[model samples]
Target: MKIVKVEEFDLRREVEYGSAEQNEAVRTIVSDVKKEGDAALLRYTEKFDGVCLEPAGLRVTQEELQAAYSQVEPSFVEAISAAAANIRAFHLRQKRNSWMDLQPDGSLLGQIIRPLKRVGVYVPGGKAAYPSSVLMNVIPAQVAGVPEIVMVTPPATGGKAGIDPYILVAAAEAGVHEIYRVGGAQAVAALAYGTDTIEPVDKICGPGNIYVALAKREVYGVVDIDSIAGPSEIAVLADDSADPAYVAADLLSQAEHDEMASAILVTPSEAFAKACQAEVERQLAELPRRDIARASIRDYGAVILVDSVEAGIGVINKLAPEHFELIVEEPMAYLGLIENAGAIFLGPYSSEPVGDYFAGPNHIIPTNGTARFSSPVDVDDFIKKSSLIYYSKEALLQNGATIVELARREGLEGHARAIEIRLLKEGKAGTNNDNQ
Candidate 1:
C-alpha cells in the first residue's frame, strides 16, 4: 500500500464494463437462449461449466436439497439458519404495506405496494461457494412477499459435477425451493426469457463475473436487475486513536475479494498511517489469497494523509465507497458527516464482515462510486410500487381547466381536448371550448 497526501490520492477507479468480445459473446449467448430456449441453455452450460445435463436435470430436485443437508455439518446448518433469521428479520423491517389517501374532493390517491411475482437470484459457483450471498439475496425477496424465489448456480462446484452442498443448504434455509443447475450469462438469459425448464422472473439479483454483469445489462428492460455491480471496495476513515492492526485486517478483508478490489485508509496521523501500512504488509504475506490481495493492494490500495478526520470525511464522500469503516475515538460524532458509502461500520467491533455475514444487513451493495446515488439491496428491490389515482367527478371538474391550460401550453391539443371533453360532458366547460 502506498502512502500519499489526500490531495495526491485519487479514488475514482475505472469500472470494468467488459471487453468488446465479452459483450458480443454475451449477446450471442442471450440471443441463442431467447431463440433456442432450453437447447441453447444446456449447450452453454456444457460449454462453459464443463457439465452435460438434459432439460429434466436442469432444475435441482427436492431430493438434492435434502441430500445437501447430509453433506454439510450440523454446525453449518445451525449457523446458516441463525444467519438466515437475522437476514430475514432485518429485511422484514423494510417491508411496506399498500396504502391510499382520501381527499376532501372525494379523490382516492396513494401507492399500491406489491411484491414481484417471482425473482431469480444468481449465485456464483465453481471453485468457491457463497452461501452468504444465497442468504443475502433470497431472504430480502422472501421478506417482500415474492411468491416464487428461484436460484441459479453453476452446475459444477469446486470443478466437480455438482453444486456446492453449502450453497444448496443456504438456499433451502433462505426459503428458496426452486434451485437450478445453471449459471453465467446463459442463466441470466434463461431467467429473463423463460425456457421449458426455468420460468421467467420479474427481477434478477446477485453478483457475478463480467459476463454475468453484461448479461444483466442485456436483459435489464425485459427483467429488472439489482445493479451492475463493480469490484468490491473498502475505505477506512480512522484517526490516531484507532488500532493499526485492526485497521489492517479490516482492509485486507475486502482486498482479498479480487485483484480489482480496493482497500484504502484515510487518517490524520502520519505515524498511524505508516503503522497501518506496515501492518497491512505483514498480514498480506500470510493471507491465503495473498496473491490476489497483494495485487489489489499494490494497484488500488492507499493510505491517504488528511489534515484531520474532518478532512478525511470529505475525501470519503468523493470516493463513495461500497463499504466504509469509521474507527475514530468517537465514531458516531462524525456519522452524519459521511455523505456516501453503501454500508457503514462504526467503532472497532463493527467489522465489515459483520454486515457481510451475520449482522442482519445485506452485503450486496453498490460499487465503483455508485453509493453516491444508489443503495444496498433491500426489500424495495424485490417489490414495485404503482401510483393510484381515483379522480372523482368533482375533482376532475375542479382541476380540468388547469390541466387543459398546461397541456395546451405544451402544444399538445389532443391532451387538452381529452380533458375538455370530460369537462364539457360534466357541464363545467362554458364558452371556453374550441370544440364548439
Candidate 2:
C-alpha cells in the first residue's frame, strides 16, 4: 500500500473504471437481446454461461425453490430467514403514506404514493454467490408493497438452472414472487423489455458485472434503474485511537473485491498512517486474494496524512466515498461533518460487512463518487408518486383570472382560453372578458 501525505495529487483512478471492451460487449449484448428477445437470451446463455435453457425452464418454479431449501442445511436456512426478518424490520420504517390537503376554496392537492406494479432484482451468481444480496434487493420491495418481485441469476456450470440454496431460501423468506435462472446483460434486457419468459418490470435494482451496469444504462429509458454502480470503495477517516490492524483489515476487505476497488485512509496522525501501512502489508500476506488486494492497494489505495481531523473530513467529502468508516476515538463527534457518504459506519464495532449482511441497512449502495448525489437502495426505489388535484367551481372562479393572466403572459393562449371557457360556460364570468 502507498502511504502519502495529503498533499499528494497523483493517485491513480480505481481499476474498475470502464474500458472500451466492456462497453462494446455490453452494446452488442443489448442489441442482440433487443432484436431477438428470448432466443438471444438463450444464445447468450450458451455462449457466455455455457448453459442452454428453454424459455419455460428459464423461470424458476416453486418446486425448485422448495428443493433448494431441502438441499441447504437447516442452520443456513434459519440464518437467512433471520436476516430477512431484520431487513424487513429496518425497511418497514421507510414506507410512505398518501396524503391530501383541502383548501378553503374547495380545491384539493396531494400526492398518491403507490408501490410499483412489478420489480426485477438482478443477483450475480456465477463464480461468486451473494445470498445476502437476495435479502437486500427483495426485502425492501416487499416492504414497499410491490405486487410482483422477480429475481435473476446466471446458471452455474454443468447446465444447472437452480439458484444457490442459500439465495433461494433467502428469496423465499423475503417473499419474492418469482425467480429466474438468467443473468448478465440478457437478464437486464429481459426485465426491461419483457421477453416471452420474463415479464417487464417498472424498475430494476441490484448490482452486477460491468456488462450488467452498461446494460442498465442502455435500458434506462425503458425501465427505471437505481444507479450506474461501479467498483466497491471505502474511505476510512480515523484519528490516533484507531487500531492499525482493524483499519488494515477493513481496507483490504474492499480491496479484495476487485483490482479496481479503492481503499483509502485519511488521518491527522502521520505515525498512525505509517502503522496502518505496515499492518496492511502484514495482513495482505495471509489473505487468499492477496494478489488482487495487493494490486488494488498498489494502484488505487492510499493513506492520506492530513493536517487535522477537520481537514480529513474535508478530504472525505471531496472524495465522496461509497462506504465511509469513522474509526476515531470519538467517532460520533464527526458524524455531522460527513455529508457525502453512501453509508457511514462509526467506531470499530460497526464494520462494513455488518451493514452488508446481518445489519438491516441495504447493501446495494452507490459506488465510485456518486454518493455526493445518489443514495443507497431502499424502499423508495420500488414506489412511485403521483400528484393529484381537485377543484370546485368556487375554487376555479376565485383563481381563474390569475391563472389566465399567467398563462397568457407565457404566450399560451390555448391554456388561458381553457380556463376562461370553463368559467364562461358555467355563467360565472362574462363573455366580454372585462376584469370588472
Candidate 3:
C-alpha cells in the first residue's frame, strides 16, 4: 500500500469488467441456451467447467445431498445451522404483509406484497466454495415465502468434477433442495431462459467472478438480478486513535478477494497513515493469497492524508465503497457523515468479516461505487409489489373531471376516453364533451 495526499491520489480504476469478445461470447451462450435449450446448456457446461453431464444428471439428487452430510466436518454443519438461524431471524424482520386501507368514500387502496413464485440463487464454486453465501442468498428467499428456490453452482470444485459437499450441506440446511451442477454464463442463461431440465426463475441473486457478473448484467431484463457487481472494495476512515495493525488486517481482508479488489484508508494523521502502510506490507507477506493481495494493494490500495475527519467523510462519500470502517474516536458521532456505503463497520471491534460470515446481515452487497444508489440483498429482493387502487362511485365522480382534464392536456384521447366512458356511465360527465 502507498501513502499519499488525498487530493493527489487516484482511487478509481479504469478497468472494464468484460471485454467485447467476452460479451459476444456470453451473448452467444445466452442466445444458444435460449434457442437450443438443454443442448446448449450441456455443451457450455462441458466447455467451461470441463464437466460433461446429461439432461437428467444436471440436478443434484436427494441421495447426493444426504451423502454430502457424511463428507464434511460436524463443526461445519453446526456453524451453518447457527448462521442460518441468525440469517433467518434477520430477514424475517424484513418480511412485509399485504395491507389495505379503506377510504372515507368506501374505496380501498393497498399494496399487494406477494413473494415471487420462484427464484434462482447462483453460488460460486470455482475460485472458492462459499457455503456462507448459500446461507446469505437462500435464507432471505425462504423467509420471503418464495415457493421454489433453485440453486446453481459450478460443476467442478478445485479442478475436480464433483460438487463441493459444503455447498450442498449449506443449501440443504437453508431449505433449498433444487440444486443444479452448472455455473458461469451458462448457469445465468439456463436460469434466465430455462432449459428442458431447469425451470425459469423470476429473479436471480448472489455474486460470482467477472464472467458471472457480466452474465448477470446480460440477463438482467430477462430475469431480475441483485446488482451488476464490480470488483470488491473497502474504505477505512481512521484517526490517530485507530490501531495500525487492526486497520492493516481489515484492509487486507478485502484485498485477498481478487487482484482488482481495492482496500483504501483515509486519516487526518499522517503518522497514523505511515504506520498503517508499514503494517500492511508486514501483514501482506503473511497472507496465503499474498500474490493476489500484493497486486491488489500495490495497484489499487492507498492511505490518504486528509486535514480532518470532516474532509475524510467527503472522500469516503466520493468513493461510496462496498465496505466502510470507521476506526476513529466517537465513530457513532460521525455516522451521519457517511451517506454512501454498502455496509458500515463502526469502531475496531466491528470488523468487516464479522458481517461477512457469522453476522446475520447479507454479505452480498453492492460493489464498487454502486452503494450510492443500491443496497444489500434483503427480503424485498425476493418479492414483487403491485399497487392496488379502487374507487367508489362517489370518489370517481369527484375526481373524474380532473383526471379527464389532465389526460386531454397530454393529447392522449384514448386515455381520456377510457376514463370518460366510466364517467359517462356514472352520469358524472353530463355537460362535458370536451374530448369530442
* Backbone collisions counted per model: 0, 2, 0
Candidate 3, residue 95: the lDDT equals 92
Please, what are the lDDT tens digits per residue for candidate 2 over residues 1-436?
7778877844335445368898888888888887888999999988888888888888888888888878889999778888888888999999999999998888899999999999999998877888899888888888889989889988886766656777777788777748888889989998998887787899998889888988999899899998888888999988888899999999999999988889999989989999999999999999999999999999889999889988989888888888999998788888999998999999998888888888899988887678889999999998999999999889888888888888777777778889999988887762333333
Which pairs of residues clash in candidate 2, taking residues 3 or more apart in a chain or in different chains?
15-260, 16-260
Give me the displacement of residue 70 in model 1, in angstroms: 1.1
Name the regions of candidate 3 deviating beyond 4 angstroms. Answer: 157-160, 430-436
- Two-way lDDT contest, 2 vs 3, winner: 3
Q: Assess the local accuracy of residue 239 in candidate 1 as a C-alpha lDDT between 0 and 100.
A: 90
Query: How well is each residue in 96-116 modelled by candidate 1, as lDDT tens digits?
Result: 999999999999999999999
Q: RMSD in Å for candidate 2, one decimal?
A: 2.4
- How displaced is residue 11 in candidate 2, in Å? 8.0
**Cα miss at 331, model 2 (Å)?**
1.7
What order do you get sorting by lDDT, best first?
1, 3, 2
RMSD (CA, angstroms), candidate 1: 1.5
Off by over 4 Å in 1: 157-160, 430-436
lDDT of 3 by residue, 1-436 (tens): 7889987987565658788898888888888999999999888888888787889999999999999999999999999999899888888999999999999999999999999999999999976899999999898888999999999999883335579999999999988899999998889989999988999999988888878888889899989999877778999999999999999999999999898999999999999999999999999888999999999999899989999999999999989899999999999999988999999999989999999988799999987788889999999999999999998988888888888888888888787888889988877773255656
Instruction: Give TM-scores for every candidate, taking all chains together and pairing residue i with residue i.
Output: 0.97, 0.95, 0.97
Pairs that collide in candidate 3 are: none
